[model samples]
Target: ARLLKQYQTHLKKQASYIVEGNAESKRALRQHNREQIKQHPEWFPAPLKASDRRWQALAENNHFLSSDHLHNITEVAIHRLEQQLGKPYVWGGTRPDKGFDCSGLVFYAYNKILEAKLPRTANEMYHYRRATIVANNDLRRGDLLFFHIHSR
Candidate 1:
């Protein structure tokens, strides 16, 4: 019973992360919505109409985005990740007892904190997330950012 409850809790968390990520991605894409459709047919679903109200409704629903909802989730994730940081490194370690590579560390961190399963490579993680192009001044606590480190 306890295990099942934990599994369900994790499932709900992952679901929430996916929804939030999709919401963020959708909002970010709206800036280039028109040009994007013209340039890349393979990147998205069939072109959406400007008159689409469903998207707007979803945005409204997620808008207020109270800090309580976001903050607690992040804290939980971080705590879980911190607990495993000192684990031994392994080639593809994703658990605390084994060691982690750079991407594995990132993947584990996000999975632990965000309940979001990110790709196991930095490049892949960059590509998997929405391209929101956040400026340095606009960064928030949980916002993911990438920096080019001496040509990788």
Candidate 2:
């Protein structure tokens, strides 16, 4: 939420001035991006592994990424989910303002962003074909990969 607030604030001000005013707000907007780097050290581009061709290609061709779009899709979802960290886990609840269950959290995060029509139940997801089959090792950012945790 802090990130979104800063982003909106910056956008509203950027066109109004050409000086450090927008620059300052831009810094604030980027604070979340910096925090994301801190939170995910492994994903951060570094010098040591720069020789790996796959990493090199991915870094070189972040073709769709914008400056503000620094985070992976999963990081964005994680950031949204982090806002609900202290809230009570309510069964069958659907919104952040109310509360959430496991599926509710998934629903709230991906519904509008992904334009996905996910079923309300957790297990029904596997029955749906909208979800692409991704191997564990092939998981990419923002993927809604699931795992079986226990017997019901």
Most TM-score-accurate candidate: 1
Please give, for residues 91-117, the per-residue lDDT of candidate 2 as tens digits.
Answer: 998888889998888777755433235
Candidate 1 local lDDT, 1-152, one digit each (tens): 34334544754664454234575677774444545444534233344456557545434343223355465555555555576766776777665666787667667766643423556777887787434666899887755678788884
Which residue pairs of candidate 2 clash?
Answer: none
Model 1 has an lDDT value of 0.56
TM-score of each: 0.49, 0.48
Candidate 1: 10-residue stretch with minimal lDDT: 57-66
Give the residue spans of candidate 1 off by over 4 A: 1-64, 112-116, 129-131
Using lDDT, give the best candidate's number: 2
The per-model lDDT (C-alpha) reads: 0.56, 0.57
